[model samples]
Target: METKNMEVIYQKVANILVEMIPEEWEKILLYAEVREGFSQIYFYYYPINQKQPVYSLDIVDVFNIDKTLHRKLKQELYECFEKLWNEFKVQSQEQLASLTYILDNMGRMKLNYGYEDISEISSEEKQDKWEAEYLV
Candidate 1:
């Protein structure tokens, strides 16, 4: 996908997150720009800190170069999102709201150069039924 398209998609994903967990909105931060032909996208969430302005949360970085990578990146983004959503669903409304507020304001964070990959065992591999599973 094009850099412009990737940025648009990233924004949409961020908006979806904002809508789902409005209280945690402050924890969410997005920094994306086009450099050369690639779109460098960073998604972050920070903990709350009233005294100091800056806080840091987890960050996911992706380089979107084509439709395949774009799709992969979106899939990964949603998986993490789902995990957080489920966790928040069990919390009180007030607590949820507070968390969302912290997420929403996570601002001006930058990406580091090094990258790490998160790996998990495929369900099929775990079950020893490769044919029954769909590849991501």
Candidate 2:
């Protein structure tokens, strides 16, 4: 895809996030991983007084976003992530088949993408690594 087009897609994603996130929350973090035959994405929110995130998919209900808008956001996010995965594969010369990313907040827009072997790692270890990398 062209750089301009990607930029537009990114903006669309940011816009959706802005609309969906609650005003009272400090920030929300989205983590996604795509590999071979598996892919998943989840969101976690940090409220003003919370030390740890209150993880939930209840954002849809909380935001009171209509089903159509929710579907649109999901589609845009999936497409953007698919493009990122493909680009990573090309840039890395196909050495990596898996890609994961942590996208935090809209204004700060901290995006960190990398590849890791989850099959060999413990879930606890994965959680620890993510917290260390992004929560701090």
Candidate 3:
């Protein structure tokens, strides 16, 4: 697809995502079936490391679009797939990991951990704290 069309379609994709996605979601991954006529589009979300996507949305019948629009959307979808997917993967992983850790240790929490940079808190300091607190 050409640049102008691609930009418009990118806008369309963003609109669909914004409309469909919840504010709390970390990221969304979209997959489209490219075809000359009507095509199906699928959306995936990874809330965890799992065998399949945690959430899926089927955009095949969105607005009862005609074949021409569907074809155009498919082309744009195909072109934009890689960039969108890569971004979602990179951004979601860290957020999901942090959430998982907090939830898994909610009842048994002792030490506090920050998801972002913690270079100031040295490993030796942590080991000393643990040994002092628990070893006695």
Candidate 4:
């Protein structure tokens, strides 16, 4: 694939991430370039308190660029976005207890059913389940 095409895809991914995590939009930084005939993309999100930036997320080793992987990557990116959005909402509501509970339960859920399967679970259901398990 051409570098321009890869850059477009990278931009799309970055846009999706911003839309999903609006709170982190200002904090997020995206960089993409072609190195050695391969596309390289980076995602960085820095917190307000942190002096040094942190590399909290990434998608590396992207060699074979195709439509299938592009679609799958978009889906996976959205799944992660939804999860992060849910976490942010819970945290904003001052539901620390519920947040922790959900994190733990979601980890188990991921372990049992896998991340792809967990994506099928609605955001509301996730929130409700966490509330039931911990907030109540």
Candidate 3 lDDT score relative to the true structure: 0.39
lDDT of 4 by residue, 105-128 (tens): 111211111122234455557545
Q: Once superposed on the true structure, which residue ranges of model 1 sit more than 4 Å away at CA? A: 29-114, 120-136
Q: Write the per-residue lDDT of candidate 3 for residues 72-132, one digit (tens) a residue.
A: 6545654554443334345553321110111111222122222453335555564455335
Order of all candidates by TM-score, from best down to worst? 2, 3, 1, 4
lDDT of 2 by residue, 1-136 (tens): 2355445655665676666555556676776666656555556777777777765467666666576776677767767666656655555543333333334444655555454566576556765676576666
TM for every model, in the order presented, reads 0.28, 0.63, 0.35, 0.27
lDDT of each: 0.34, 0.60, 0.39, 0.36
Ranking by lDDT: 2, 3, 4, 1
Q: What is the Cα-based TM-score of model 2?
A: 0.63
Error of 3 at 108 (Å): 37
C-alpha lDDT (0 to 100) for residue 9 of candidate 3: 44
Segments of candidate 4 deviating more than 4 angstroms? 1-13, 19-25, 35-37, 56-136
Q: C-alpha displacement of 70 in model 2, angstroms?
A: 1.3
lDDT score, residue 74, model 2?
A: 70
- Error (Å) of candidate 1 at residue 99 is 20
What's the lDDT for candidate 4? 0.36
